[model samples]
Target: MDKKPDHTGYWRTNLKYLLILLSIWFLVSYGFGILLKDTLDNISLGGFKLGFWFAQQGSIYVFVILIFVYVRLMNKLDQKYGYREK
Candidate 1:
């Protein structure tokens, strides 16, 4: 007898959130941090240049936020899909 695969709803939901979070990361780190550095450099935040801060500290902070966001989103998704690892 052949076995059928089980469809886990949580997997798709997690993947969707993961892709979105990563896209935002890429845009902030690569696009704004490097590609638009010149334009950003024209702006200043306090004592630091916008682009420089984004490239160094800003992106890092955003990355941390993204991680947290992903975790939260995943946890919610898991509960919604009845996949929470209680």
Candidate 2:
């Protein structure tokens, strides 16, 4: 017989990972792009200002990669922890 899962533990684990990822998202978008824009303006990426690149392009790419990475990582974690959906 399959054992009942500790739902609270599952939720807690998910919440912990979600919060951490969201915090990093906020930091890169708001912190590096907006809050530190002025400080980063002096820096350049080829011909573009570092902050502008981060705000418009870099963040998008990072976000896409982050999604894939999260999916791959969580799938592995789920398997390792026996929480994967059949």
Candidate 3:
């Protein structure tokens, strides 16, 4: 009998990472940009208020970083689970 491909574990791990990364994205974008704007505005970053920077530039940078992080995490997960394409 042939063994069925087991993807549930891999999918679960993928979803977990996605949820965590998305939560971080949401916190950085919404929390810093809007909810905590007043507090972060008191801090200056190269002539731009911290909150404004997060709203305009910081979040984008973080999102890019998160993309790389997700890629790396998935690669490792694939290797660990023997799911990588030969």
Task: Specify the highest-TM-score model's number.
Answer: 3
Query: How high is each candidate's TM-score?
Result: 0.85, 0.84, 0.91
Clashing pairs in 1: none
Q: Could you tell me the TM-score of candidate 3?
A: 0.91
How big is the positional error of residue 72 in model 2, measured in Å on the Cα after superposition?
2.1
Superior by TM-score: candidate 2 or candidate 3: 3
List the candidate numbers ranked by lDDT, top first.
3, 1, 2
lDDT of each: 0.82, 0.80, 0.93
lDDT of 3 by residue, 1-86 (tens): 85555689889999999999999999999999999999999999999999999999989999999999999999999877777576
1-86 per-residue lDDT for model 2 (tens digits)? 98876777766777777787778888888887899988888999989999988888877777787788778767866765678666
RMSD to the true structure for each prediction, in A, is 4.1, 1.6, 1.8
lDDT of 1: 0.82
In candidate 2, the residue pairs with backbone N, CA or C atoms under 3 Å apart (3 or more residues apart, or in different chains) clash, namely: none
Off by over 4 Å in 2: none
